[model samples]
Target: MHRRQNVRRALLLVSFLLFPVTFYYLSPYLIIMGAGERTASGSMVVFGVMTLTALVLGRLFCGWVCPAGGLTEALFAVQNRKANNRRNWTRWLVWVPWIAVIILVTLRAGGIQRVDILYQTDHGISLTTASGMGPYIIFYAVLALIFVLSLTAGRRGFCHHTCWMAPFMMIGRGVRNTFRLPAVQLSADTPSCVGCYACTSACPMSLEVQAMVLSQRMENSECILCGTCVDVCPHNVIRYEFGRPRSTNPVRPEKP
Candidate 1:
């Protein structure tokens, strides 16, 4: 694994431990590391922190700190080859919950009374913004699917195209390009690249790394900062830098 990947693993372990403990032992919302406090009291604080982190760090948290991301990465590692050839029918199974949550939340937000057909719990509430079943079942299902998919797909398929968290983080990454963090960079010497397409194929996100090398447009909004390109670069052309500026220069390198 690369350095950023190692960081992601560490964050994943901590997040996994934290999620259950927070839900059962701490608040139902799992805001602070404290006892249960109803309403959005502490949970809002946690949400605030995550939102703020994204705004400042340009999706760095997604690649290096999210448990869901870590689980997906692990799933991709299982097959090590031809992971994309497989598809998870189980993802369709998950859509039931996803749509149900969206409907229930929309209803609740619009002040419509719900019959509770799909979910049964004393906890009557919205799922989308809440720290309840909105995330709980979704998180579990995503984890399981990642593992199952890994046996076939061998790459971060779920995260690349379908992560719910991506929209939130991308919002931050879009406007906050001014604050760059450490990332792998392509060098001016990239012309020496032999078009092996190793970097592109290595990318769990399916980003066209070879094209990014040639055009140097660095237009990598979909990049999850997984460092696949850096690891696959044989020419020693890919480099890492800390706190660089976003470039109007087409020669600018793609990160992660």
Candidate 2:
């Protein structure tokens, strides 16, 4: 693995830690910052920094820094090593989060009544509503359930299937090429290639990197660019690059 990739991974982990711990602790209600009321003490500062980070790094924030992504990566890692069965269900399984978020956000915007009476306020919580009765509750339940499923199904099942945020990021990354370069390119030397499927297995998104080695193009835009494959490769045959450039030997700079 390249030193820069390792450094980027470290930076990502650090940033993710700050978000849920420092940032979220300081301001539990995410919308309180700029999304709505300014009750969070350091909400503005944290929000500003996070926004700037996202703007500068683009989808790299999610792939490398986001704690939510970290959870998926961890789950996938466990699933890759321990689980043997591979499920083929794709369509609905992959896009469930996107649909759920759309519905949840729509209801929230529409002023769907929330029942939050049972829940006690955690730190940094300024507002409370009745729970146990609302579209929002359904969203919360679904997200939680999907996360649990991720433990069993493996490879960020919720991220791949239901995260509305994933689809949003994936779309932008796809259109602007803001995230990881698309596709896994195989090195020229075939005999040197040991044909280990570590890259495919390491992928948190469960992408088909082994297959892409032969074709030299990724079929999906859902790749998060965590570089687990790059880290695992012994032969270093699989490399993340902009899809094979027009020129024969296009030199794409490695992502930080």
By TM-score, who's the top model here? 1
Instruction: Quantify all predictions' global Cα lDDT against the true fold.
Output: 0.52, 0.48
The TM-score that candidate 1 achieves is 0.58
Kindly report the root-mean-square deviation of model 1 from the true structure over all alpha carbons.
8.8
Candidate 1: clashing residue pairs, number: 3
Residue ranges of candidate 1 with Cα displaced over 4 Å: 1-19, 22-38, 41-44, 80-139, 145-154, 178-189, 243-256
For candidate 2, write residues 49-83 as lDDT tens digits. Answer: 44444332335555776655655554544554332
Q: After superposition, how far is residue 243 of candidate 2 from its true place, in Å?
A: 8.3
Report the lDDT tens digits of candidate 1 across residue range 88-117: 343445444654554455455553332221
- CA lDDT of 128 in candidate 1? 35
TM-score of each: 0.58, 0.52
Best-performing candidate as measured by lDDT:
1
Q: What does the lDDT read for residue 2 in candidate 2?
A: 63
